[model samples]
Target: MSLDVGAVSSSKNMGGFDESKEGAEKSGVQEVGDEKQGNVKRNMSDASMYATEDEEEDEEGNKIELGPQYTLKEQLEKDKDDESLRRWKEQLLGSVDISNVGETLEPEVKIISLSILSPDRSDIVLPIPENGKPKGLWFTLKEGCRYSLRFSFQVSNNIVSGLKYTNTVWKTGVKVDSTKEMIGTFSPQQEPYTHEMPEETTPSGFFARGSYSAKSKFLDDDNKCYLEINYTFDIRKDWAAT
Candidate 1:
């Protein structure tokens, strides 16, 4: 079995080739208007509240560490009785019939870290939940500044050939727009891979202020999606206010 790993990064930059045309023609990109933006406001509100909870110090009153703080195996071992952990394990393993013992199983993929990068290539500190549950990854961006999205992950038993990314933008809880892009068709390997959104593709402009998410799907040689992950963040108009 070959281990496949895939990565995706996205941004809005001026003067890049219009890849959107080809992506649209291939039905690789899909967008929905405000009518389908329902409940986004509520979701953002919940995320904001969760961000506050994540900031609270432990009993010792020290700031909590950030980034990939724990692995699924560690969490499961720590709380074997946790129903949530069990459910997550099932999702990762997928459904398999007992009689299909000879069938090949999908490779397991683990996300190492997903974060935003400043123009200077430094990692921006965002509140990430230690247990992997979605939390508001909030950060400040100047009105017209650009930022890059970064993703890193590992695969167990397959080579990754490509990556599909879906990006959605929501403002004041309303989904303003969405886009999809394909990264590559590459050889398979096991070492960690880091993908960075092209500089010109980094998102910018005054209208970029909002809450957004990027969902990435790792694909194999057959163009079949094997592993997926999500990342959420908020673009604030002012860095000093929060």
Candidate 2:
């Protein structure tokens, strides 16, 4: 079965039509047996009968409304699992609003190198760790670590890159807000999800969100673009001893 994709964004007719019929009772001023004059026109189920109220079909069969189809956690979890998605998240992270805010991390590059063949087939070694700065360098590493690696990078009208990463088997790829935590391991696709859930149900998904991006542009020898990533992770207290 094909899964529905895309965000749920919609709008309702909050206001009325532009034309103003301030005092216009253009249509018949009243329904034959109604006391209210021309207030409304409703369709009646039986013979050519007109009702003077908005149709409120209490038993008009069942109406199915799909909404909030995916959760931020679901999206973030899928993003981490899919290589292509991780790239997009990293790109989105890169494009986050960065104006009028005191700088967070000093924008800088850790590695930049060009390929021998095309000069454009460059590779910047960028590794995002599980319990350290997922981006940027000079950050210390913690034991019991899991990480993602960007193997290669190329730049054009759009960016192209290769990637691979491992799951945090022992450290719980499943992360949640402080109050709630992953009590067990779960594979979203393994079993059927809840058939019917209340509206705005928080999705059970992964966290410890991290992203990485790399772009290559051919330039004179000294040309280079800095590459860095940022993430949050907890160090394994016992693993550090080993």
Candidate 3:
């Protein structure tokens, strides 16, 4: 069939050239594609994509977050209320390995490092040390192996009070009671808090002073274990200079 060559040069005018319904539809499709690309750019650039797996369910619930992808350069160009900074902090704090404590046999074994961080500055290195398993960043936790913990503390007047930590580390300490126990003020009363009460709203500062703790046990085959628990935790706060 012979085709009308005039249809090919729609961008230019022809004697009988007219904007057809199909042409409008094609234009709309192009516009939509452009919009979609724009959305991607915004999402990737926003600052709420950087929460820990569990904190992702925090009360802030589903709020957009900045993540690892966002960089300092982006922050310099973002809005004052930009979430990228918070996301950046979370990215810096990162995730912890709750799978298992390494060195199962080392009773003197300080199955020591169990931490849950949010803007928390300290690294959470759960001791799941296993032999010949490609140590550090190369192990995957087994299912049901993700044992849950209370991961909490006691408080008195905005400060942590008598802190108690109990976990089935190796079945050593008393059974872990989920209820919070009021630990008297931290040693020296004037403990340094992450200190969120900043004058101006700041992105957030890592307060290594505030202490938090969790209890863990390292049970042996004979229902025996050691109790050298320590739960010194710190808080991370976000702020913006108003």
Query: Candidate 2 — which residues are off by over 4 angstroms?
Result: 1-51, 57-62, 65-71, 87-242
Candidate 2 C-alpha lDDT tens digits along 59-80: 1242223222233234345548
Candidate 1 Cα outliers beyond 4 Å, as residue runs: 1-105, 125-132, 186-188, 200-232, 240-242
- The positional error of residue 184 in candidate 2, measured at the CA in angstroms, is 35
Clashes counted in candidate 1 amount to: 13
TM-score per candidate, chains pooled = 0.46, 0.16, 0.18
By descending TM-score, how would the candidates be arranged? Answer: 1, 3, 2
For model 1, residues 57-159, the per-residue Cα lDDT tens digits are 2322332222232232343354668888666544433332323321223434555666656564456644444453355554445444455666665545422
Predicted candidate 3 versus true structure: per-residue lDDT over 25-57, tens digit per residue: 111001101211010111121122232222211
Q: All candidates' lDDT scores?
A: 0.40, 0.22, 0.22
**Model 2 weakest lDDT span, ten residues long:** 177-186
Query: Number of clashes in model 2?
Result: 4
Which of 1 and 3 is ahead in lDDT? 1
For model 2 the local lDDT of residue 24 reads 15
Candidate 3 ranges beyond 4 A from true positions: 1-123, 126-210, 238-242
